[model samples]
Each structure stands twice: as C-alpha cells, then as structure tokens.
Target chain A: MAIHALIFDVFGTLLDWHGGVAREASRLLAPVRPDIDGGAFARAWRDRYQPAMEPVRRGERAWTDLDTLHAEGLDGVLAQFGVEGLTPEIKRELVLAWHRLDAWPEVPAALTRLRGGFLLAPCSNAHVRLAIAHARRNALPWDAILGAEFARDYKPKPAVYLRAAEALGLPPGEVMMVAAHTSDLVAAAGCGLATAHIARPDENGPGTGEAAPAAPVDVAASDLADLARRLGC
Target chain B: MAIHALIFDVFGTLLDWHGGVAREASRLLAPVRPDIDGGAFARAWRDRYQPAMEPVRRGERAWTDLDTLHAEGLDGVLAQFGVEGLTPEIKRELVLAWHRLDAWPEVPAALTRLRGGFLLAPCSNAHVRLAIAHARRNALPWDAILGAEFARDYKPKPAVYLRAAEALGLPPGEVMMVAAHTSDLVAAAGCGLATAHIARPDENGPGTGEAAPAAPVDVAASDLADLARRLGC
Candidate 1:
C-alpha cells in the first residue's frame, strides 16, 4: 500500500492514558479518599469512556467532546470507587489528567522521524482540545490533529476512519491507521485503510494490552521507534 | 483577554500566494501563451477566490474545499487569459501551486517562537489537505489544522472563528485570530476572539495590502516576528 499519512490511535498507541490517569487519580484522590485504589479509579474512569461515547456514536445524544463526556461520567466513576470530598476545581484538574498524558518513551523522536515521510495525525477518540493539549505536553510533531471530533463520532465507526482520510485529502488506501489495539486496526482495515500494529503490551496495565497483532496488518512492530524504522523513516 | 491559541489566515498572511501562484502560472503558461501576464493572472485567480466562496458563505452552495474551487475557477481564468495547451496533469500540478507556496521569509521562525507560548493553527478558508501540504513545505509549526473544513464554511463567517475557538476548547475571548487582512481580524473580533494584525504590506502585490489595521485590533505589528515579540514570545 502507498501510505501517504499515518493516523494514530493516540490513547493507547501513543500516550499512556492508563498510567497517567492512574497516577493522577491516586495522587489527587488518595488525599481525600484514602481507602480508594488509584488503579481501580483510573480503570473505572476508562471503563466509562466507551459507554459515554456510545450514545453519541449511535446518535442518541449530540456530539460531546471527551472532556465534557469525561466530566459527565466522573461522578458515577467516583461513586463506583466510593470516593468523595473532591472540589469541582480538583475534579476539573482530574479530567485534565487525560490532557496531561505522556507519550510512550521513544514516541516523540520516532514520530518526528516518521513525519519526514508521512503526514502524521492522531485519528483517536480524543477531541481537538484534548489532542492539542496532549500533543503539546508530549512534544508530538503532528502535521494535523484529526479523528472523532472531525468525524463527530467515536472510533470503531467507519465514519471516523473515512472522515480522517477525507480530511487529509487521501483515499482510504493511501492512509494507514496505526494503533496498538487489534480491534482498532481491524476496524480500519475493514474500512480499506492500511493498518499498522504497534505493540503496547502495557497499555491497559502491565502485560494487559496487545503484545502483537491479532489480525492482518501492513506493518507490525514492537513500539513507535520500531514502527518508524519499519516504515523507512 | 487571555489568549490560549492563535488562529491564522493562510493565503496572504502565512504564505506568499500572490507570488507563488504568479510564478507557477507564468512558468507554465508563458511558454505556450507568452501574451498572458503572470501577475495579472495570479490577481485574477485570487479575485475569483472571494467570489467562489461567496456562494458557499451565502449558503447557496454545499461545502467544497479550496482545491476544488481553485480547479473549477481555473477554466474561466485560462479562458480570460486566452491560454491553452495545458495537459490535465499539468493543470492539476498548476492547481497544486497553492500547496507549494512558500512562507514569507520571517514566518517560519516567527511561528516557531509563537508556537512556544500558544496553540497555533490556520483559521484560513483552506481545507485540511491544503493546509497540511503547505505547512509541510514551509516548516510551519502548527499544533492543529483548524478553520474552513472544521467549520464547514469559509472565513469571515462567524462559524469559522467560533468553531475554531470551540475546537481548541477555549472560549472565543481566549483565542487570538492572526491575519494580514483587516477584514479577517475584524470578523474574528466580532466573534469575541482577540485579533492580531501582521502587516503583509505586499500581500496583494508591491505595497498593495494593509500596512496597518484599518480597524481596531488587539495586537498590531509590522510583521509576524514583530507580532511575536509584542506578544512576548
């Protein structure tokens, strides 16, 4: 495939959301709710992420950005962990934890190399605001910020893949969806976009995420740097 | 107003489209049709630009990117100049002149410095593909591609300004709209976004564009670097 652009799954593929959210959740919540587990709070928040986007993806609700959806789901997640006593200011800071996510080590420089040959963007569920904040904090030299907000829907949906390629003025076949998730890669491949699997074995937690592609892909590598080398960047 | 992001106008503000388009059009057409003036031809194409987006801005036409509009406008421009003999491939390449346009000499480094302090993006009428291609060619350090396609309309439209602010997850007052044209900054100011005027004195031709704001703006400077320094970047 003649890939002209690489659209990434940012959360797991580029940024370590689980680790970031877990750390921040524990750091803030531990002072208030000493009995709560930071890892469990992070997982609870992430668990609600899909369900929050479900209504919008299915058109049951209007297009809502990640921060808004995250804020809307925060109370329920807090209750699930029996956490309390956090002020709205603290809660806002906690939601912004997603925006403060760090890239996997080797990602910044690797993406810089890959960018030499391909238009790089995150075709993630993250909204433009979160994406920009996250990219700036992590030093991602993306040629564009794209995906869900541009599509007005969430991932695993064909529109997300199609809209991103359209935004890049590329045919689906000329764009490659790079993700650590097998389901995400499969979804993109089904939409006729090329797929690259970047193994993020610790994305969910240690040894919890994909260690390798579970399906066919145009490129597969152990991490972002390896993926960059494989792509001849 | 606290400015968290700076959105820009592309054609005359960031890139020297007047010169670039003139050079390409003259280089290509001058060989076969020596009678046509490159300067006038470039002016003719640019004159058609506003008229082309007028229908869309007035809601008389569906959303269409600049590439399509430029391509459509090409035939009339060629006929206006009585030019002929360009192959389809040559014509396509000519249309891509917009993507290959270079930044004004001070723009690249000025934008790099500006990007250090605020989120930077093109709030131009140009679509994502056009923006990405142009930015890559010029080494523009944009955090995201915002504007037309994102708002589904051309600039000077309130949606173009407001939607761009929305995309950056900031209130209108927290974003600065940067452009050489007074009309663009005025439009942005009307939308409650802060405005910066960077004098592109030769944007239309030698000393043809604005040397200063025709109306009030939040920041007014001689050029982008001057503007950056004024903004403390």
Candidate 2:
C-alpha cells in the first residue's frame, strides 16, 4: 500500500527533549541548588515517563494528560535530588520545558520536503497543547497534531497508532509511523502501519540512544533528512 | 485577557464552502441530471447539516463524524432531487467535496500575518480527517486540527468550545473564536471565549450571507484582512 501520511514520535524523533530538559533544569536549578545535576534530574524525570502512563494504559487510572504526569514526576525528581524551596511558578515553567525543545536540526528542512508529498503529524505522548508549543518554537510545519490525547492513550499501544491513522483519514497501511524508538515502530507495525526508524544516536543522551533500530523495521536512516531522502521526499 | 490563539469556523469563515460545493455538485451532476440546479442542491445539502446533527447534538445518538453525516445527507439530497444512478465512487467523491473547498482569497494572507503572533486552529464541526484534507488543499497554517471529534459534539454546543480551549491548554478568555456566524460566536462567547466576527457578504451566495454582525461581537471586520488589521497582526 502507498504511504500517504507520516505520523511521528516527537520527543525522540524530532525534538531533543533530553538536552532541552537538562538545559532548562540546569538553568532553573543552578541559582538555587548548586549541587543539583541537571542531566541527572532530566534523566530521573524521564525515567518516570512510561511508568506514569502505565496506570492509564492498564485502566488503573482515568485518562490523565502528560502535563499532570510531568508535574507529578517533577515533584518526585526534585525530592529525589533533595532540592527545596522552589516556587510553584518555577515548577510550572519547568514542566513547559518539554514544549520548548529544539528540533534535531535536519528535521525541519526534511519536513518541508516531506510535507510536499505526505500529510505530517506528531503521534506523540504529548497532548495537542504541547504539540502546538513545540511546533511554534520549532516551526515543524505539521498538518495536524494527533496521537495521545485523541487516542486518550500512550505509545506502544495499538489505539495510538490506529486512531492517528483514522484521524489522518487513511488506512494504517497508508500511514507510516516514524520514530527513533523500535518499540513505537513495533507497535505501529502490529497495527498494520508501515514503519520508519530515524536513528537518533543521542536521543536519551550523547551515545545513549540507538544509532540503529533495536528491532526489525521497514526503513532505517541516520536522521530525518536521510529518511526523507530514502523516502524520495 | 490577551488572545493567544485564534480558533476558526472553517466552513464559512475560512472556506467558500457554498461556492465550492455548488461547483462540485454542478460539475458532477450537470453531466447526469440536466434539470438539477447546483446552487439549490448545495443549499439543500447544507440545510441538512444542522438537523442531521440534532440527534447527535441532543445525545439521542452516539457521536457521528461529519463525513458519515454528509454521506447520509447526500443520500437524502439525491433522493430529494429525483436523481439516481450515481455510483458509490461518485457518491464518495461527492462527499469529499467538503474536504476540497477553496479558502476565501484574503484568508490565507491574513492567516499568515496573524500566525506570527498567535497559534491558529480550525475549531470547525469538522472532524480531524476533514480538517487535514481542507488544510492540505488550502495550505491553511494550522497549529493543530481541533473541535468536534475531540469534544464528541458539534458546534453551538458548549463542549466543543470548552474542549477546544482545553485542548489548546488555554483558558477560554485567552482564545478568540472567529466565525462569520452569530450562532457559533454566541455559543463560544457563552463558554467565556472572546469572539470576533468576520463579515462574509457572499458566504451563502451573492448578497445572501451577513455583511455585518447580526448580533454583537467583540470585533467585526469587513473580511479576514480587516480582522487581522484590527487584531494588529
């Protein structure tokens, strides 16, 4: 089947969330808690991401958006670092760090090219608000923002991929899931969508992310530009 | 309160749906039903729009997307016209006329100017798929596709406005609802959103649509360009 649209994993695939979060955390914490390590704090907060969504995924909790999850996780991370006396405004600003992430340089130009050929959207765990904020800062040129909130579920779930394709008005076969993570690709593949893995060698941190797919995928490229080229964008 | 975003009423405010639908209906039916009046057919089809949604709007029926609604409406329209023998493909193509509308000439440039300072989205009764299709055809620079499907309800219902504001992650006061219709503007204002009315003198047909607000609006303009100027875009 012809691929008519590409639904993306925003955090790892498009934006440098780990670095952005680390930078924001450091900028905010350095003035108050000199001993706090921003990288460690970012990693610790990220570590709670999937676990936070687990309850919603398992139906153990009602649908909760990522903002709440990040806010809750931030409290735990701040406590884990023994940091104190931060203002509520600071916490709110810190949670918004995910929205202010820098794109992975080549992503925008490649997206400009790809937009000419296919409908593009972010099928991420981030809600529509975060998607708009991310696109505003990065100028990502999205046709729409899809995934989590529409599905009311998170990644690695069939609903996210299925509902995203449905939202794009395409069958799963005509919608390709583009991500840096193999788990997202596998889940999309299981839903009959095509999959592309854009390698992000440092999505987690420098050298911590995959330089190649950890599992089978139909297409794999060094970055979004490479993926665009391979897809003849 | 500052308006951080502008959510549009896609059909009349941004797109020339009546003209586009009339043209499409004429193009298809002129070759078949020689006696059919395209404008009348377009008006008849649009006349069904509100009533079809009444059951869904009143909660007498489950949520139904516009495509399904339009398809059903098309069946009634064809029968009403005493026309028959349209293939399923032609019927499907006819239904997609809603997705292939031409934007009002000044709307895009005005939108481009407005986009620099505020996020833009279509808060139409349109579902995500229809929004994507409309945006693809017009290159309307939407930050996200929002409205009906998200609210599981149609316009004039407070849920649609309230949920769209929630999805944009802003209070209703910070999001301006822009429409050519007083009903939509009134509904949105009741939900605490700021409202702007753009006069579309020919939205329904020549001299048929509103040349000015029939009800009070926060701002009223000759067209989208005038609206942009008043908004300091």
Give me the candidate number with maximum TM-score.
1
**Residue ranges of candidate 1 with Cα displaced over 4 Å:** none
Give the TM-scores of the predictions, in the order they appear: 0.97, 0.96
How would you encode candidate 2's per-residue C-alpha lDDT over B1-233 as one tens digit per residue? 59999999999899999888988998888778967877899999999999999999899999899999999999999999999899998999899888889999998889999998788888999999898888878878888888998788998899999988988889999999999998899999999999999888888888888888888889998899998999898
Q: Kindly report the fnat of each predicted structure, to 2 decimals.
A: 0.93, 0.93
Error of 2 at A52 (Å): 1.4
* Model 2, position B153: C-alpha lDDT score: 90
Task: Give the Cα-based TM-score of candidate 2 against the true structure.
Answer: 0.96
The window of 10 residues in a row where model 1 chain B has the poorest summed lDDT is B28-37
Please give the lDDT score at residue B26 for candidate 2.
Answer: 89
Across residues A1-233, which tens digit of lDDT does each residue of candidate 2 receive? 59999999998789988889999999988889877777888899999999999999998887789899999999999999998889999999899888789998998899999998998999999999999888888889898888898888888889999988888878999999999989889999999999999988878777888899988888999999998898898
Instruction: List the pairs of residues colliding in candidate 1.
Output: none
Q: Alpha carbon lDDT of residue B65, candidate 1? A: 92
